[model samples]
Target: MIFPIRSKAKVLALALLVISAATWLYLSVGETEYGRSLGPVAPRFSPTASLLGDLESRLQEAEEENRKLRLQLGEVRNEEQGTGLGSEGENSSHCDHRSLTEKCELIHVAIVCAGHNSSRDVVTLVKSILFHRRNPLHLHLITDSVALRILGNLFNTWMVPSLQISFYNASKLKTDVAWIPNKHYSGIFGLLKLTLTKVLPSDLSKVIVLDTDITFATDIAELWAIFKKFTGQHVLGLVENQSDWYLGNLWKNHKPWPALGRGFNTGVILLLLDKLRMIGWEEMWRLTAERELMNMLSTSLADQDIFNAVIKSSPSLVYQLPCYWNVQLSDHTRSEQCYSELADLKVIHWNSPHKLRVKNKHVELFRTLYLTFLEYDGSLLRRELIGCPTDGEQQETRQEALSKLDEEDPCYDFRRESLASHRVHLSFLPHQTPPADPYDVTLVAQLSMDRLQMLELICRHWEGPMSLALYLSDAEAQQFLRYAQASEVLQSRTNVGYHVVYKEGQLYPVNLLRNVALKNAQTPYVFLSDIDFLPMYGLYESLKKSIAQLDSYRSPKALIVPAFETLRYRLSFPKSKAELLSMLDMGALYTFRYHVWEKGHAPTNYAKWRTAVTPYSVEWAPDFEPYVVVKRDCPEYDQRFLGFGWNKVSHIMELDAQVSRLVFLFNGSL
Candidate 1:
């Protein structure tokens, strides 16, 4: 195009006119990109290769800026999702607004859980953090590599975008604790949180570490707040522990009386990483090597003592948190659900040195709360807070706790009554029928190893019409059979059959064991008995008459005499039914022939249930009735069932199914 040269001012005026026109055109009749501007409308320069390069450079800078902005935007979205912050139905009561309201920072939370065995407790603790804390988090676990791997995989499975979890192998910390006695705290569970100060990342300025055996009732953001609360010299932020021994130790030994409140529970601690770094761990290790320090540490509560001793000169160095922050092993009176209000409790610590020895049913009842919380997704607000009074386990666990506390409180009323209603009983009755002719029945028993004397006593005391066959497992332990033979019990007895056979696995398959005896029984009639059972000849005679009266001596009849546990040892083997009866306890009725909870009805007594024992009724408790005198041909036991518990149930189930000309009878011999 042809153009005339013009002055700079006129050209500038023309450029301004074009820019004004383009702005008016854009406002009136828009271009591309919906709801966005297309930059300056009038071009400053015409299109050229070098101009495009400058444009590309500027575009590259803008692209980089956009990339950074997108990254920041993504982080905000992730933080919102992960923390559930500003989201409906999330914990907001104690969330630090300053932290949550701004660009979310990862609140690094350090926890020391020993291993996979401790995973359940850690899961609960971590869940509690998620449920309560409305901030991005970095969960650091001080545990074995194995446990770290397990938790890492679990956290990944959870896929919480806002939260980042990492595991530090604290197994190496064992070297730091190597000198401590195994009976001591460090020896038993490793060095614990003391080594955590050394193990945590040096770059991590602030972190809250807690023991696995804890539950957070408050949002963990409140815990993180303590790091900010710390004054100049405080290295540790911990809950004031009211341990009797710690109080006594401080009072008796340290010149100035240290307040009990000054004693801290390391279970929940906030570490000032920067300060701990300055404290110098070499000095701590040096204290361990010193004779005087080791002697002082030899005291039972050594872990806390080391902390106390190091910070003794300046108690101000230990920032004591309120007692409610960590309630230690205190609530034993009611289950957690029974708590009318947990408003005061921010955290609860199950701090018994001997939790395994807890005897208070109330304490155990309270423990159920901790256990339930552990199983929960770590949100207290979402939990069903009611005591499980109906749980049979609550009763059992309470009894255990009570047993432990029994020596301490004599008048502690065991609210859950003991199970004194042993539904099993025995009564003496005169024989209604004359004794039948003695038909020798072979008594077969399942065994891995037999007590030679007990087996001989059972065999010798076994009166007219009986023989013994033991299906010994062909385990390496079967060599105990040699011990049995060496004892002269077999030599002293008659027809004591010792048959050893190999079963594939290590387990004592009770059904297969019974089937072995069933198939091998030489007599037309087989009396299945446990090796421990002592058969009374007199009872046998009465039972034989019952079978003969029913004409089941050779018929397919299953005669089960209710068995009884005896105080009688091998030496105390009763010769007659009268003597055996004296040694007998209550009937072993822990088992039911039929499940009472299901369709099958459990009988009230031995006599009432006797007629009902068969395959037709699905509800039957066919158990070790001592002598199940079925014909040798009666369907051999089903070997499909496994273990001591299910194998016999399978047999009962089969018989109850009416598989054969099956008849159930209660012979009075047991």
Candidate 2:
């Protein structure tokens, strides 16, 4: 083993080089589960861990940036309690108390509504939000063609300050979420929530998605302030499900979707759009659904099931909201405990098939609030467009321009078109203010300038709300406003709304005028009539009594008010039904259009109406144009019919076609 010093050194260097080569080769060829090589690569990193780390880093960056912005704005969040953003505590006072100006941000709200009656619920939901809102809103609606038409008309008429609306047709997403099986009555509409981030504008970073069946008791600004409290790693905010359906103990063989604890209700949700996109939410949800659908037949709660599944898989993504924000009134859940503990109810969610009729001890209180918003006068939401000091200048300019309008030539015809395409002006002069309590029945009618005289006589006889759509030239409209201001009877009333449609080119859009009047009406019942007719004495009060007596509000029906006309314009108006009958026997009066068109009044069965003591149903007949008291949401008058011919006839025919019964009101008439 003896050798020269240089020979031994060479041997040591060669051995070290061989060992270094072996280690480099081993590192270049990465190891697999079976210790196999996959070419030169760095040491492996766990995909799960990397994904988690990247997501956390992105969220932390966002959180820090937001915190810095808040601090710059002179806002400080409590570090000791960690802002209590997603805490599950019941007594958390996380609501921000800063000035509205400091947080003057547009609140984005999304709603998925379809079907014919969906707009009705949505109207109430919007009303509830507008009732207590301090901040402006930008509402996003996902609806069908039918709901689009109805909601378009309604929201366009509502002139709330800083309220902006955008609509997306639900049909565009028919293919995206349709593959998943669902058994809920809402059908595919319930699944539309899964595609909100896809359907809404890409720039939208956050939104509040709400079910149409809910109402708000507090300012929506209170809820909007919550987004400022979200910490890193939280992408959604939701309230816990109040029912046991998710617990899988509702029945013997119940096989509900998998959930963590009681699950989360989807009626109200806060989505962080940017965070969701960053996490590849589409792929995440699709893969999750593919895995869960294998063990289930169909989802009972649609998107709700999938949402809970995702939350169960990643608990850190959700921020739990307070129960008061979503007070579930379903029959299967008892919210009395929540009510007893909370100081104020924030939102009411009618989340059951029975809705307000759900079997809950607090149903009456909840129902009362629901109906209050449902029957609320939409005109109250028409606050003037006053905003910040800069906005105030714009508003003042607008007011000056409008005042000039009042001073312009009353006879001059201005092509003033607003909101509608037909060159018509809506609410040219709306009611001064809404009544303290809504009128039981609003008298809805269409009139011309010549019929302006009838307004005084009608207002004298009827003191309820009157929604009048007038066909006037720009000049006549001015004259009408002057008349309204001068006439004591008309000036004193605060419940009369005047909607004007310009008398364009020879064809008078009678039906269009009628629809405007009907749509503007705020009462549950409206007596569709003409401006020339004067209602019999006490007809308004009597109809109110009859409405309460018949329970007509619950079961919608057309209460036929008998019509009679006189040949002489100067004849004394009938004071009572007995006097009208006496005059009829004396041949002083005849059934409306009786001499000219028998078919029109013949269907009313005047002979039977005179003797019948109680309301009786009448069969539909051709040319029947009897003025009737019907629900405000009745089929609109056919705009195709112009001038006087078949205008009312077509409307009554449509009502009859819909199987709506026409019953004679005992003594009411116009």
Candidate 3:
């Protein structure tokens, strides 16, 4: 919960600059406060008096506008703090759900979340929902104590009058959720949605209930409109289930239950509160109280399953919403099938990692959209002032974001993977000024599918006239072939080159890819690293001096520069090399021999790489193995290890055993 001092300072600076600019503009109009009180002073035909009069008028308008903004702000704050929940019977306008006649001016939306991490997702999801939808949102958030603090700060800081919200601690709501007899779960998560009739204000009907892990592509009012389409007994509406995975659990103890067909994901449910109160509440709870039902629901218990089962016999009770309304991202089997669905999607549900990895385009795009909302600083009334980037501006921001990839910025991340067939034309930007005795190290790395961004970062910091070669695998050819850069930003340097070693369908050659970079190295000294390894700030500049020492050595040797593990998720590297090394918590300096194996999930199966050297405090660790720096052609990387796995160990052993009697280690760590 600790805030970054730097970020806070930036936000303060931005606000001050905005206010300062406005004041400067007013003063520039020559309507100083002293002159304004006395009205305009006549001048000899320079139109100065006329201009001052106009300036005074505009200032009045500005003050009036400012007053209106303050009033709106006060009203929103007051409503959030003092609005009372009156009984439903008191509101004569309130209608019954059985009639499907609930009327309202504001669009009421509810989302259920628990735990700390899920609370973060709730904030982003709500922001995204508000950013796209042009309606008054009465977002009802249900969660525990931790979320109450986090979300309260976010909503209070970001709340506009148009997007008013109220947070209700789920545990505080009176419900049967805590009455799960014989169930190990302290409170059933799924049962939260079932308690809406009892928990939410009785007058609030036709509310849209959503799972926390969702992003909106269109106004939720569009989804809200689907409720009006519900006629007859069709009260509950939802997108059909993503896969048949839930069928087994639904029918596990079944006396041959009816077919669910495509089963439904209650992730985006448009509930008819009126209908639930009239048709299913008591019966549903009775079924829920059944010892066998409670045990089953508690064990693999799904509230959605119970709801779907209750409405199963009469299909009319469930109105099937469009697939795009709950566009299932986890079912990514059909590339073409997904393309058509994406074009029409209203909401996207990223339910699982196996369903969509971080690399997927939609995942990335959702991430970008998610950030856009979270970073907004406008008041609720000023939501109008919120970013409404034009098509040209949006494309410009994306393109600009591309140029700053070396910074590893999240804003520039365009996560729509539909670019699979589209090639990313990359240009390498080098140091603006070349050193007097330029470093001739050709930095080599193995490139793959989503790593062009990684290369961009290396290139951004590839200062002082150096060469970099990216060895591309068969899997990455198409992307580079038809890349979109009309002008060459990547080709900005002649020293940068790319070679495709493995063609499409061929297995990715790990060691061979490294050897190609080593063999083709055009420099006297070569620095071998992976695509993801971005050097510390001064590593490149210092390497220029380090290489000089390497060349003068009477005996030829390898320079083993150390590396560190990133501390924060998607953390940006420190601005300077000193800052990078000084940050004891940002990165843990890896003192162990850098291995070639793909270290799987650490703290789990993969071995945790560490040393007796304490994190954030380590100056050095004893040199181990051939994480060896090398003189080009003296001891080239061995290519015996094929495909993947254990590719670098043999090469290190060779360098230590035979290549050089004296190994010169580069002391500067990345």
Candidate 4:
């Protein structure tokens, strides 16, 4: 080693030369593809082998844990079986298992009517409970006069004699005490005072309290059975798990015992009277009601808040049932995930004033079903029940009246005979209006000129002065001679009148057609007719009656809208014809005179007038079809509105002050 060290200078020079060559080679070759070809291959690990080893260890550990847990569970089960404490077996008694001598009886329920009254809803609740429950039950009505009078009478007259019931006036119990600010509190203070002051029997074991609006669709016996089976360490209550900071703060400040769950809805409660007495709950209630105590605890919580605070910290006595037992009636549509729970709802608590404003079919069905629960008689029953009369007496009486009136009335036979004859012209007069002078109600069949032959029978039977305005577009006429032939056929059918208006020169087709009609119409009122719309025999008579009822200004009192029945052969176009037909069929039949024009109304303004009045009026055709307007004063439709929704709002705003009243006649089936 010493001899080698003697040549350190020479060795250092050699090492430097070697390092420089290696660096030069690396720099020159590594930058090119040829350099990469000289590199060593990397080694790969066996991931599968590693993963298997990890899994095997986990499996052994899990098996060991499972064995220990099973052993512990077995020991606990043996102890429970020996003591006969837990009612886990199929043969376990539904009643008190601890004391074999005692048996559970029917639960006595009392409805506490506090702030508001829902007597009709309560009646349904009572009826539903009675119908479904097999256990012997008694309903104790505790309410003020507002709830008692309505519910008492309905129950007395209608409820079958099989159910046992009693009524107690809660108002007579001096229970007026403030439990919360800005809200009227009832029941808690009053009921507590009654129990403490010896007004109520202290010996009572248990009582179930329900709100007035709750509906019981299924038997509650199973829930009661579960409650009885459990050790009576705590009073049973329904927990509203969604309680917020307001409730938490109440508990914090009041320094009451903490409970596991949050807040409980006072709407439904089960009180263990014996346990409450033993715990001196009456004295606690009295102290809590005192002004000094309330002032101190008021910031912490209300009566419920205080109760929860004390109960939560002291002992675990409260239990929460399924949410379906008390379904909250709300506006937000429940998702499918929540439907299973909602479908099984036994009690619906309508929590909001706007609850009925919801429009879902499921909610509507729920409401209808709930209404059936309150059946007073057939009339009330019919509201929820199908094929039932709303009133029990009306069912029998209306049937008799309908039968007798059928024999006495001759109009029905006349209508039948007229329909069978297939007469082209007939008259329908309003029941209130007298016969007036008949004016020529011109039925101008405005078609695309190709549908002329289809109108031959309609034109031939025009007994009232009628006219035909054939509006043919340049394209339609230029493209096909069949259209021209159809127009010629229509003209030949009737000599009442005919005007062939070529739409080639007009800027807008509909406007040009209307202008032609306005210039040619000789009648005081022009009937706006679509090509597909056909008049039944009594159509003009109906128009005359509607026109006669108009005010002195000759402004239409109501437009006699035509009812259009669909024909099987006519094919509809999606973009143009179908839309136009829909507008003609479904657009509002009634138009306001004020909206047409301020100075005077014309036949052209009828289109705009109809749009404005249809939404507001009740007078509509059964088929949602446009009404036949036999204008008393030839109200011109605004020709500027050639296409739909064009200048419609501006035109409507202009005539806002002129329309007085609108009538809509809705056909019930549509």
The per-model lDDT (C-alpha) reads: 0.52, 0.75, 0.55, 0.45
Question: TM-score for all predictions?
Answer: 0.40, 0.54, 0.40, 0.37
Query: Which ranges in model 2 have alpha carbons more than 4 Å from their true place?
Result: 1-80, 83-88, 92-94, 98-101, 332-334, 384-386, 389-402, 405-512, 515-670
Instruction: Between candidates 2 and 3, name the one with more favorable lDDT.
Output: 2
Q: What is the Cα-based lDDT of residue 188 in candidate 3? A: 66
Worst 10 residues of 1 by lDDT: 422-431
Task: Report the number of clashing residue pairs per model.
Answer: 21, 2, 23, 46
Return the top candidate by TM-score.
2
lDDT of 1 at 432: 16
Off by over 4 Å in 3: 1-104, 179-187, 249-259, 280-282, 288-301, 331-341, 358-382, 385-670
Q: Give per-residue lDDT, candidate 3, residue 408.
A: 57
| Candidate 2, lDDT over the whole model | 0.75
lDDT of each residue in 1-670, candidate 3, tens digit only: 5534334434545554565569668676454443434335743334367776887787787676666655555454334223221111121222223323223347888887765557646755775676666656778887776566546654553434455577777876635655543232324665678777777888877799988878887777677766876777877887776655555663556421223675677788888888878886756645634634533544333556556666665577787765667766753442213335344556777665344464455666665655455443222323432333222333354456555464454422222211111111122221232233434566767766567666557767764233333444322343454351432655565466454442312344466557655665556666776767777666766776777755665665556655656545666666754554556444344323234322321111112222212112111112222333466675665544445555665565566566444344455455
Rate residue 155 of model 1 by lDDT: 55
Better of 2 and 3 by TM-score: 2
Q: How much is the lDDT of residue 34 in candidate 2?
A: 22
